[model samples]
Target: MKWLKFKILILIILMLQVEAKADGIYFGGGFYSLSAEVGNKSTSLSNPSAYSLSYTKSFFPQISFEIGYSFLFESLIGGDMSYGPQIGVRYYHYGTSTNSTASLEGLSIHEVKSYNPYLSAGFSQKEFQSIKSSYSGFYLGGGVEMGWKKNLSLFSDFKYSQLSGPVQGKANELTIIVGIIYHDF
Candidate 1:
């Protein structure tokens, strides 16, 4: 009986410790622009607008995994619209004197203001006429998140991707994104 009680006490203590840690799920949406070049020809597509939705799971205060989907209103290659899913891991770094507290829905929350830099690799497929082309590549970028409230923030980032596939030569792309994030603690 004493051993069972001791085990129960240990479990309760561990739960309390976990509750004190900062870990949560986050959802975000934003707008993006993509520019691409294939071979010696740059796509004539202008500043096309795209939308993205993402979900992130933070296992630690500074590290998280994110998965998201993006849909372009117009194709960078010109004929039809394109869309794809992406997954990546991100790391967050806080500034020395950046900390704040706010009340959201009557709950007090804490956050840090800083920059987050990340590297990601993904694959996407676009169809032109009846021909389907696939692209796979990696991108590196960094961004800043400014906390608006305890659970909400605004952010922006830029990424450069180098892709190769059935194209005449390597296709290079530059993307810019601006968005808002909501955290569920």
Candidate 2:
């Protein structure tokens, strides 16, 4: 009976000890580094470092909708290299703000006062010089968001980007990026 009472007290203490960060739409920009392989050859690109601007809006404290656009000089350009568009979802949890595996580890959501961890999944399409030889694919990734201030957040994402077979058998592009996110609306 004593043990049960103690357990309940501990649970309540933890619940009350959580902190509130931000839990709404997060729109911002950052740089991306992409690498991929083409048949027997492999390539990597850091500069001409493309720009990715995004909007992350949340309906609930745990879930949100995200829309973003980015431009890059794909590792290998069979024809023309250009930027692409991406659309997807982002789910966040502020209960784990100190985790190193967070997507937005350096950002904060001031809607509540608790954990600061999150996961995101999205898709992107890469347009090349030739329509018949384009590259596009979907990805699933997750991480946490930490608060540097009230509006600044440092984030990292690991994406597995593959080329669509409809666009021909092109090499696959899997990328990971770490950048800053600033909240606007």
Candidate 3:
């Protein structure tokens, strides 16, 4: 019947729309904690808790790529402070990751599902007022992402960054974020 055929066509179109939505640019904001270490100083350098904004695009059904920057500042001794940015990447699948930390050297096996579990590794640095001090290192951690509604979802990750440069120290970074994704319905 004509009605039956029309319904089929509409269903197909809707499916395509959802498929497209599954992969696109996602942007949102939330809180970020910067692990303070790696700089030249005896006192611990802590960047003031701050906000972060990030962008992600799904290259495939289960695989998505993301990059973002955060700002932080903390007071040390008399009239001294530090702050800077962090960048990262991920490669994930249904509740599992082939390798969350992808780089120019390791790049392969994109996503193949709707749900993605991921790991992140990145670096951040800041300048010290006293000795041109710098804190820079890499973070290693994992996260899971779920779609709660159309173009919106919840995201969270746990990571550890090791600091080594002027002074030696270690820090733990944890983040919980809720966001309105532009894609991934």
Candidate 4:
């Protein structure tokens, strides 16, 4: 629990420093499929869901830093609940285009593309209730974002997380998230 507190504290400090330059803030909820093996029993759940909220700031031209929390609505391995904080870096790929006006102006003007695809990888801490177990691990995922309106975009993400704890042997979760992001918030 001390480590979790420390991670949260670090994220809080970063958030405060990045708040004025935050590029976007998003909230999302989605479904997760979990497969876990403990001691002698193996279990799989296909219907549980999770909700996430995050803040992001651009650290480079194509890279952004993010911090967020994910909460599971159901238990894992008969535990009361599981949830944690996540910190990740996202890389955006922007397509290049040629503008005819560049020749006349002696300069290039690229059109602002509405579709952005990104890859994300992060570390997370999972704490389980009742069982009093805590697991820390990493996740990798990728998704796309499409502009929906001014200052708003829609995004979908799919990530896989593997965690291990003293109480629970190993747990893997596949999560799919669909959410909206508001820019410059």
Assess every candidate by TM-score. Answer: 0.61, 0.58, 0.54, 0.73
Model 4 gets an lDDT of: 0.70
What tens digits encode model 3's per-residue C-alpha lDDT throughout 27-122?
A: 333344544444453344333343445666556655555566543334312344344556666666442222121112232212223445676666
- Candidate 3 yields a Cα-based lDDT of 0.49
Worst 10 residues of 3 by lDDT: 96-105
Rank order (by TM-score, best first): 4, 1, 2, 3
Overall local distance difference test of candidate 2? 0.54
Q: Candidate 3 — which pairs collide?
A: 48-73, 63-111
| Model 2 Cα lDDT, one tens digit per residue, 1-185 | 99766665555555444433333233333344556565565655554345566666556656767777665543432233556777777766643323111112233223322235567777888765543455677867665565555556666665556556341345455455556665533
Model-by-model lDDT, in order? 0.53, 0.54, 0.49, 0.70
In candidate 4, position 36 carries an lDDT of 77
Give the RMSD in angstroms, all C-alphas superposed, for model 1. 8.5
> What stretches of model 3 exceed 4 Å from their correct place?
1-18, 22-48, 73-83, 95-116, 126-132, 167-180
Model 1, span 17-133: residue lDDT tens: 332323333333344444456667665343446556776666665666667766555544344655666676667653211234444234444545554444444443332222356
Task: Output the lDDT of residue 105, model 1.
Answer: 35
RMSD per candidate (Å) reads 8.5, 9.1, 9.8, 14.7
